[model samples]
Target: MRSKQEYMEKAEELIYKTYNRFPVVFDHGDGVFLYDTDGKEYLDFAAGIAVMGLGYHDKEFDDALKSQVEKLLHTSNLFYNVPAVEAGELILKASDMDKVFFTNSGTEAIEGALKIARRYAYNKDKSHDHEIIAMNHSFHGRSLGALSVTGNDHYQEPFKPLIPGIRFAEYNDLDSVKALMNDRTCAVIMETIQGEGGIYPATEEFLKGVRKLCDEHDALLILDEIQCGMGRTGTMFAWQKYGVKPDVMTAAKALGNGVPIGAFLAHGKAATAMSPGDHGTTYGGNPFVTAAAAKVLELFEKRKIVDHVKEVGDYLWEQTEALSQKYKIITAHRGLGLIQGLELSVPAAPLVKDALLNERLVIISAGANVIRFVPPLIISREHVDAMLIKLETVLKKHS
Candidate 1:
């Protein structure tokens, strides 16, 4: 194996400079611990940006993937595949939605949802509905369709002239959304818990209000659960906590527990938009990815993963609040389940760096000043205690 520095330099020369990567090169991992080529170990709290729900090298998950790979991989969507059907059914049963369309990533799922929403309107009166209302400070995905619905001007500025008929509303503010929605609106897409927007969760009242607005206007309610769903929010889905239902829901991230898979689900009228040959993909809904997702869902059922997330998530929230009160450097703390953010008095980048380098604890920074903590759903109480110790030490040093 090559040295970490040499490998990184080589990667820099070959790959695009899209990501400013950390200096560590992980060789392998198990549970919450990752070992680098230099024999250095780090406790991972970020969990690969909330993708690894069961943690690294989970035995049952690995076995399921390997078994499915050996049996079947891909056979194109021209023919039906068992894994696809199984995964889709599992997701439908898990969610309130009735049907599902698989995709390769979260952005693709968002794109599919957008298409369904638009097409549903087009099929309706054929003249009145086309616009989609998204929230300010929302992060859906990076694809053009998802980008168009995303609220940030900074991300949208470079990719000028995106999909038309998209409007912005203030997140968690019912009045802002009410002002923008009209007869032309086909959908209102938002995250139940905004992940990339600094872990902001929609208030229960706001979600219920939006649900009513969409119902009244006959617009599809599309919830983007890419980062906050699949047991990350203690429930199997975040919308369950909000006490409102969406006509269409997009999910990815932890659906396959690190394997690339995404899905868009719809209920009732929204499901009728797509007929055969209307939309399809070569790699989407392939056996390999769907197999992984099937196993993930299976584990979710067999292991009671949601309960684990609930216990650990509550512990994390309590500890974060305690830290906020003790340090006074932390301006605020907010979130549900494992999706948490600590708003610091100063920039959190230095603290994140210190956590990695000095404390050997891995964390991520959301926005500029908020430190994000999205550990694996299966993370133990012991792991949380360990992380709390390191976090306290790091915050004290920074203060």
Candidate 2:
């Protein structure tokens, strides 16, 4: 293979420029660390945007994938597969939802979720004149339908003529949601912890109020758990923290541990919203990915991932809060458990770059100035200390 820089140039020449990707070309990963092509090891705090929960090069996860690959890769969604059935059962049990439909990515799952809401409302009133309430600064997905519900104007501006009837509301303000919500509202969609929107977990009172509004209006409550689910927030799902159950929930990222798989779960009146012909996917719920998901779920139950997250997450909170006091650059801290952020007085991007280049630490930015820390779910206090060392070195230089 060529050098990392050469590979990057090849990619830039071939692939369409969507993401302003980082500089390094990661060759592989082991445990909580990622190694670049040049053999530099970096502490991984981003976890591939909260997807690699079990961490890199996990033996059991790799074995599960190899076993599935040797047996069957895919048979399309036309035929029912055993792994799909097993995974679907596990997902339903974990989510406590009645039905589920798998997709290849979180964005596609959001699309399915939007369809579920609209179809359910149309079934009741025989009208497509329904609106969805999304939160400001919320990031769902980049697809047309999902982008419509996403509250970022920068992402949605160029993609004008998006799907109509979508309204933006404040993240934790129930009154703003109520202001846009009415009889025409079909669903209220939000990230349970607002992952890409600066790691703001909704207040319990606000979540309960939204649930009440949905109940009053007969609208489904859709929670996007794509980034914050699968034990990222010290719970199986962030919404579980508040006890405000969603009528519909979208999950992905760590569901397959690294394999591409996403699902939108539904319950109560929203469960039977979509019939057989309503939604379909080519490779979703196939033997390959579902087997991976089943193994991940089984490991979650067997290993007690959530309890571990809570312990280490509390430690992370204590440590970071202490750092916030020590450093003037840190204005504040937000979030719960592993999905946390430090509100920086300086811009987060340059510090992120400095951490990557100087300290070989991997972190990402949420919004403009908040440094986001979404480490692997399997991270320990030692990993947290490693991250803090690298991060403080970079932050001190910035200060």
On TM-score, the candidate that comes out on top is 2
Per-residue error at 192 for model 1, in Å? 0.1
Q: Whole-model Cα lDDT per candidate?
A: 0.91, 0.92
Q: Which ten residues in a row have the lowest lDDT in candidate 1?
A: 121-130
Residue lDDT tens for model 2, 156-175: 99989999999999988988
Best by lDDT: 2
Model 1: how far residue 187 lies from native, Å: 0.5
Candidate 1 accuracy as TM-score? 0.98
lDDT of 1 by residue, 344-367 (tens): 889989999999988999999988
In model 1, which regions exceed 4 Å deviation? none
Which residue pairs in model 1 clash with each other?
none
How much does candidate 2 score in TM-score? 0.99
Cα RMSD (angstroms) for every candidate in the order listed? 1.1, 0.8
